[model samples]
Target: MSTSWRIRIMLTIHAKLVEAMLAQAHKDHPFEICGVIAGPEKSNLPLRLIPMRNAAQSETFFKFDPQEQLQVWREMEARGEEPIVIYHSHTHTPAYPSRTDVQYASQPQSHYVIVPTDPAYGEEIRSFRILDGMVTEERIRMINSYKAEWELSMEAMVA
Candidate 1:
């Protein structure tokens, strides 16, 4: 049997989640906030916002508190979840990862999202897939439910 399969990666986010992240970014303006939106392990569905402390606490960069990071990762493991979206904000520049950002990307599967808190670019958000030092940007679909999208895809396949 010749089993050939195609790999499909769909990146999606809820509007409410975006709003929450933007709020956090604004609240921590000029200091750069970092967080994660985790879902079940290997699931692309992002369902929670975990606002992490920026250990660096500087406007130019962010580093998750090592202690907090360890604790959060353990909690996520306990919940059978993993980081789906690892997000941070750029206070003075556009919503794009910096050189250091790309170098420090540890999650090849997670969406590396950047949100600029400058207020100059309203509602601007970008995501990229960093695999082996290469960055590929992905489109974000603001959906109400991934289940609905899944059903729609299934219906199309059946038709």
Candidate 2:
């Protein structure tokens, strides 16, 4: 494990993004739903939600359609954006990265979010950083709007 993984970081995402993710998960219940949230490069802010089709289409696993993945990547590059957050749903299990997820985590910089759709688990969305097969849970700070959140932070800093 590296020192960077030990640092406690908060994932500040807009509430609408969260809702959209949850909705997608619910719509694809029993099967895993996966997607990525693209943001301005180096911003660490997730702004655009792009839900992807699960090529595997299995309840236990998810794999992005290769063509779709390439298209999305190209689109993000054209827009000067990066995949800041990669999200998926665990229909029957808790929101935690599995061994396969850790092994396949290609973007070490992106936040890996797991949304649980199991009725027994209640509403809990977990965020993590999967780097070199190490998974580190992160806190989420949901805000109504990015501008409002930024202004509040600026005010607090000035005070």
Candidate 3:
């Protein structure tokens, strides 16, 4: 097994909202769902929980709204957060990145958090760094001074 590395990620978490998102996702069942993760960053590290919005439902995948996302990034920069990462969940799959996932990633510096909500491994969360189609898991460590989301960010549980 590969040991994890701690990423000094600046986290932006909303207490009630994150819980609500997870609950809604758990209720959706089977089909994959998606959402947006926004926050502030310092030296490229994230530090705030701006907001998470639902992705449009699709047949085999969930697609995020690029325009809206850009708007969010712009707003984050306006407030000093900037686009640090993009997060989503895997309804019935492992937390590892799939080939399809590798082909679609656009943010090389940002962390990719995958939530495996499989009934057998529902509590497992995983984090990764995908760059130029190569994927490597990154360890997520909770900082003593930081506040975690009421639930998890798909990254925290796996770490």
Candidate 4:
């Protein structure tokens, strides 16, 4: 039994969305922001990202808006995409999950990607899979420079 895990992610997005997210994150200096990533699921990959509309308030914490998320999920389904991961940024903290994070993380199968923007570690990103209060570090595989991948094969192996 180990604590390490990996999440395979595929990224293909409009450049504007990414820039907007980064800019927004940089602007909101001390609050954690969140968004969604959507894409098609290949043999072993899934598409996911944080949504901009929900990221405006990051200091308090984040909770997915069911209606908005459902819309994205439905949109993905219509476009043959799958919601594979959930991403959020930690304002001035590490990417590690907080106690609240553990309690609030309700998704059992989706990978959680955390972006830590501490001054000491700008743009530090990491992923984890939280289940039953167990948090494990998950490796991120970049499918390409513009596209990243996270494969949960390690978790599967452990399970």
By TM-score, who's the top model here?
2
TM-score of each: 0.86, 0.88, 0.67, 0.66
Please identify which of the two predictions, 2 or 4, would achieve the higher lDDT against the true structure: 2
Q: Over all chains combined, what TM-score does candidate 4 have?
A: 0.66
Off by over 4 Å in 3: 1-21, 50-56, 147-159
Q: Tell me the TM-score of model 3.
A: 0.67
lDDT of each: 0.83, 0.87, 0.57, 0.61
RMSD of each: 4.2, 4.5, 7.4, 6.1
> Of the pair 1 and 3, which is ahead by TM-score?
1
Q: Estimate, for each residue in 48-144, the C-alpha lDDT of model 3 and write its tens digit.
A: 5444444656424556677767777678778766555556667766768878778888877677766666767566556687889888887654343
Sorted by TM-score, highest first, which candidate order results?
A: 2, 1, 3, 4
The best candidate in terms of lDDT: 2
Candidate 4 per-residue lDDT over residues 1-159, each given as its tens digit: 332322232222344544555666667656777766655553234434446454345575766666877787778778886655577778766778888889978766666777676767667567787899999876664433333323334345446
**By summed lDDT, which 10 consecutive residues of candidate 3 come out lowest?**
1-10
CA error at residue 67 for candidate 1, angstroms: 0.5
Candidate 2 colliding pairs: none
Write one digit per residue (lDDT tens) for candidate 1, span 1-159. 111111125468888889999999989888999999998765567888899999999999999999999999999999999999999999988887788899999988799999988877655888888888888888888877678654444544455
